[model samples]
Target chain A: MELRGKELNKSIATRKKEVLENTSILSEICQFLELKDVARMRSVSKIMNVIIKDSQFIWKPILQRTFPEVRILDHLTWQSLKNVYKSLRDYHYLTFEPHSSYTVGIIGSLGKLKPYPDIHSPEIESSGIFGGYSNYLLGKHIISISVLSIPSIKSIRKLRAEIQCWILQVNGQAQGWENVLDEHVTNFKMNQIKSSQILIVINSDQEYKTDFILDLEKKFKIVILKYIDNKTFENLTKAILKICRNDGETERKVYEKQLIRTNIDENSVQETNDSNNCILS
Target chain B: MFYNFNKIEEVKIRLRSAEGHICEVEESAALMSSFIRSMIEGFNEVTEVSLPNINSVVIEKVIEYMRHYKDKDPPIIKKPIISSKMEENTSAWDAGFIDADWNMVVDLMTAADYLMMIPLRDLCCAKMACKFKGRSIDELRAEYHIENEFPSEMEENLEFQHPWRLE
Candidate 1:
């Protein structure tokens, strides 16, 4: 069945006339897509773009339906709302406009590590996640945790400051030097280390007298690090290894006595290092 | 088969256009053909008002559409509630209308949108989207005048080398 009719007009004037009537609807459609400011949206002919920004343009109700919350912003767990907003405004779309606002996901403060009030301590300052909007409230958007009760304003401000500092310094460098604290000290994966060896490096000046050192020496499993010459440290490691290899009971006992006196041991330290081989964290 | 009427009797009565054009027309016929009358009404409301950059051709089509459906139920024509069969029928018709050269299709769509022809404009753009689907990045760039700004090896290195992409 041929369902057709000869309604075609060959004149340019006719074609132009029909298209002229359709321009108003086209402008409304572009606004509905929420692409008025988008470069690609702007490229849909010059005339359409001009009427896109007008206040009289009432968009359809569906356009008002909220867009899916961006999970990408949540991945920036360490960024301040300000920094996140800036990155998003520069790289991605955030309902972005000069007068618009963006909201980042909520972030809890480090002080949120505190337990319940009945179990509180003075050293654990009362800090919390604040639903704060910073700058023109445009750059980085964050949805802050809702406060159930009135909290101390000063404490929350302190938390906000710390959170901002953390966001600014999130460059993959650990918070402090590894040698100063020891490996795995500040790491979250403490379970990865099956055992721990307390290695104490003591200064050798005459004023280095403390009950702490005497108390440490009472253990036959510690390694006391002193300001010894390089050669002496090598000799000490060799002697400790030799003691572990000995078969005689008397020889082992003698080595054990030396470990207690000088605070050095080899067998236990080697075993501690071996446990970390099979774990990922 | 014709009834003779005196010229003086015909001259006794007068007809006027909606725009105040003195002419001859059958009032009964004009009332029955409500589409033409409404088109004239639309013209009176819209003309003498300047749309700075709008082309004349688009306006003509809008008028043609207004003339076609003016006497029909306005709200029903504007927003049709369709059954499954009706939707399928409309889809088939829309597909044919939109199947045209890309530039012509875009022009029609842009025109339809500007004048608030919702159904026609939406179907055409959706057809365009289907045509664009599965196209290669290079093809898309060529068609849309988009630039491949990412340097060579960028696709491979961007994920692994960036510290943020790591856990």
Candidate 2:
């Protein structure tokens, strides 16, 4: 592929060189006879016409140059390829020539133009562009940019640090301990927070890792909580085993791994016999 | 050192100036082809690369844009925060950058044209049109450096009273 590309480029360069020399020689002969340019040369009748008609003649190189990229003879003429690259390259400046062209403006339906309110507006200001509500209450806004934030993995990792700083922005108030429960509930209601949360515990009895899960459950209902699944869970388990087995916590590691891998349903209650068997065995 | 990132490409382009300082542009297939075509026909390196219409200021702006966008993907039809006030209350950054005399604006547009920077050229041209949005042809001529070519009677007949201007 590379070799073919190089050969093609060389061919183009050769053609361009021939065209350049032809133009230069024509201009030189025109200058000698005090003729203006190509148009004037064309006006000099039969001999010039015969010179132009010859395929290999230097004078008619312009016609050949018109369609250099076209190899098939069916569409090789200058007039046929007038709208192609040659004409564009030659007449680029013509587009910008004053008085030669004009501009047209097409106005569609003129919608009611309303003045956008400043920051001091009393109510929530919503303007619809093709109908996606921009939720701005009391002038808190989101400025949509032309470019998307194509975050790298490094940038995505930095987002964890910024999570602490990202205020949920609930009505101009920051959520702390006093508001965590209600704030979480409000976000849940607004469909903003995640419905599920995962808790991973390795070697619960020996390392007191169960204590952390119990404390969390005491604070918030574990309505949708579950452990990790498959490959990632296996990797995490291996890492945990590597950390704990060397630290004299074999009993806790065995029990906790089994407990986490087990799935539970909140709505369905197993029979008392099965429940006892689950907890005991 | 020039082809540090990519090994396959091998060509060099020289951008020249009046002081004879030649800045070498690393060859990419697209740019090198255009450069070679320009350099043909007794036009040397200086004549090929030197944009006579683009002064240093506009060239600096084009280079700035290129630097900013080198590693980025092309922008789609994402609507940027167009200043809420239809030609008023632009962000200070955008306003200040674009607020140049008409000559500088035209120079920047020409530079954008030479560098084939579509967005910059379009922005400058659109800004020029926006500035003359509701104005008459006579007003546009006065604002731009365009000379009036109409006969006096025809010019009088074509006069339009602009709606936006208080005067």
Candidate 3:
């Protein structure tokens, strides 16, 4: 028997045009598709390929949906967002790598090790899982540092001046290093170390002991940083504050208040003479 | 044909399908469709709405969904819910409502898409997406009627590169 009718309607079983023909429907379908499906759908046809690729142009929502709770910055474009996502994926399969580099004239700083730089500290390797995005070697790193004494001292006051110069250099290397009694030590420790030095510890004549053998190994961590943006290369205090702020909203506010308080106090203003402070301080 | 015997005033909506069939549904149930809602609001006096794209069978399925979730809002499935949990948590009725052949599901999705019924669209699409997950290239091609664009040798190489297929 042949089926005949005034109107022959198409069966719903043959229709799939909402996903194939309609743009918004196709986009909504694409959102539900798995990542591998998205990649595979590209191979389906030229139209599907174009649609999926265009979806990436609106990548901010896609990325947020992919990884919720991450505060994605507005400045991150699609290309950069993809790069960061790929790098993060790369992080899972990362293998360990060893790095051994040295810096001289460091009295006692190890990589992130705090308290007394003792050379007998087991020859430890660094966690090298993370590396530069352009140039940031993340995670723990070991650095062998050598100590040096003042080159020449003309007088006692001259030795104190040289010691102050040395303290400035060490603190300069630590960049954001802060110590409550750092200035006090620079003013007094030069003469005290000499008096405390056993008479046999001199590298030269007693009257003009410009050099000494004091192996007081203390562990201090090594940190060298260069912020990405050039605008951050202003006053060291401001740069440090700016970096702290970049971490999050709450920390930024707390650190901002700290910077304001620290900026107000000076040696003269606070009446603490570094020259008159105790030798060990 | 509403079950109400009280003979109270009830608003009736007329929907014309693509096959030229007219379906009369209650205004409250029809308002669940954003497209129909807009039409009702836009032309307050109009009783019938025409949908030239959807057919009788798919339109009946769409109305079944709309009427089911009319009084209470359809619980939105955030983050694309489709799993054993989706089957477990969904009422026996919702599961049965969307239970159709792949092509029928696709048709219903199209109808829901036309009506701007987001929940039904999402449900249908996610169901299709579930069919694609963990299926091989051959299985997907068979199921979705997708043409295999790659030769055996190239497809083998892609499997080697992706390695996700290996799992």
Candidate 4:
């Protein structure tokens, strides 16, 4: 009885192997797996690796299922689909908090951000001048960085030409900083600033300086106040500071709306007024 | 000839499995399989269908699924399943229904494919996916009995090419 049972188990195992060896069946199985799982499956065997890497049949359905909003153009090859999957996985929204007293500069190459294992709300701080480089693994390129809550339009007007932004890419050899942001770019509205390059706001007038060096293998450093004069840095800092402030009115209105819904009595109205005073103050 | 609607409802379809065992099912339930439906519709007064690839065990399981879902549709399993657990990804009944051993699940999947039962095929696929989900490459190879064919250097190269696979 024991011998027969062993043989039966062996047959079943063989049958299972046969099923997976069939490419058509394997493809069906892969369709149900997540992108990461599918990517990992490529390492299981040579056949699986070829099946996954070579076939569009496996990727097309998985891509459509995972990201239905992403349009699959006719020209996209199998490799492109794989790249799209990886790119979407790596894409993130990065928030930077520059210190008030220090001149902050962000220097890094695009698309070299390291992947974090866990998904968390990331808030990168700008370290002070001569403050050792704080390396932030960011995405391929900056699509848009909107100031979360602008204080007021009046403050925005005060921010004009105060913030200087630059995009520095060091290819093979070291080069000087290129001032990428023009006057029009500096004169951005309350929430309409869009740039493909990095945005660095430095309070040039202050003695405290924060230099951001992107930790790349190639030694690339942001030469502080070397290319542009001090006036540009001061203007850049004012604009950035204005953009970063939290809108007090918006916060108070949200609080008022919540309080009014919960409390209908006259005492609640008085409490709402008190809360508004607290927020404004 | 004039046919009564009630008479058609009372009809039973005979499904002959590979083992030459005959199982009777209500015509309505049997119609869930598109292959069976086509067979019944294409041929005149045909009630018996032979399944050469599906054995008695798998056919019975398929019949169980067809009967249960005859009145109402099975719940759709979402793509890119959220959880490794089948229960979280699908209805409790479905999760339980597909709670058989891996070999049985694979057999049912093949049977469902042959019979053109898309929902059952999809359910079987999801059950199999739950096994593969969140598993490491070595774990997957062990689970499926797949041997790593690539040399160490090639494996390292592949890993370098796909950095996202690294944690």
Best by lDDT: 4
TM-score of chain B, candidates 1 onward in order: 0.43, 0.49, 0.83, 0.91
Backbone clashes for every candidate come to 30, 1, 5, 10
Q: Candidate 3 lDDT, tens digit per residue, A1-281?
A: 13433222233223443355455655665565545455565445445545655664334455557644232322344344444444445653133233222111112221221222222211111211111101111232211122222222222243332221121123222333234124323433555533111111111111211111112211111112222122111122232323322445455445444433343332111212221110100
Model 1, clash count?
Answer: 30
- Give model 3 RMSD, 1 decimal: 19.3
For model 3, the interface Cα RMSD in angstroms equals 3.6
Tens digits of per-residue lDDT for model 3, B1-167: 77876877779898999988998888999988889999999987879999999898888888788778878877555544445334643556666777787668877887887898888887876666666455555564554455776777876665665544334
Error of 1 at B148 (Å): 3.2
Tell me model 3's lDDT, rounded to 2 decimals: 0.45
lDDT of 4 by residue, A1-281 (tens): 99999998888788777766677777787788888888887778787777777766777678768654343322335455555655566653222223322212223322122222221112222111111111111234211211211122233333323322322222212332222222323434233433322233221222212132232111211212222222232222332333333234454346434434433332222222333211100
Instruction: Check candidate 3 and list the clashing pairs.
Output: A115-A219, A116-A218, A116-A219, A117-A218, A117-A219
Q: How would the candidate models be sorted by TM-score, starting from the highest?
A: 4, 3, 1, 2
TM-score (chain B) of candidate 4:
0.91
Candidate 4 chain A lowest-lDDT run of ten: A127-136
Give the Cα error of residue A108 in candidate 1, in Å.
Answer: 24
Question: Which stretch of 10 consecutive residues in model 4 chain B shows the poorest summed lDDT?
Answer: B158-167
Error of 1 at A103 (Å): 14
TM-score of chain A, all candidates: 0.20, 0.16, 0.27, 0.31
What TM-score would each prediction reach against the true structure? 0.27, 0.25, 0.49, 0.55
Query: Model 4, B47-163: lDDT tens per residue?
Result: 999998989988889999999999999988888777889999899999999999878998999999998998899899888888778889888788777778889998888788776
Those runs of model 2 whose alpha carbons end farther than 4 Å from true positions after fitting are A1-281, B1-14, B23-53, B73-96, B136-167
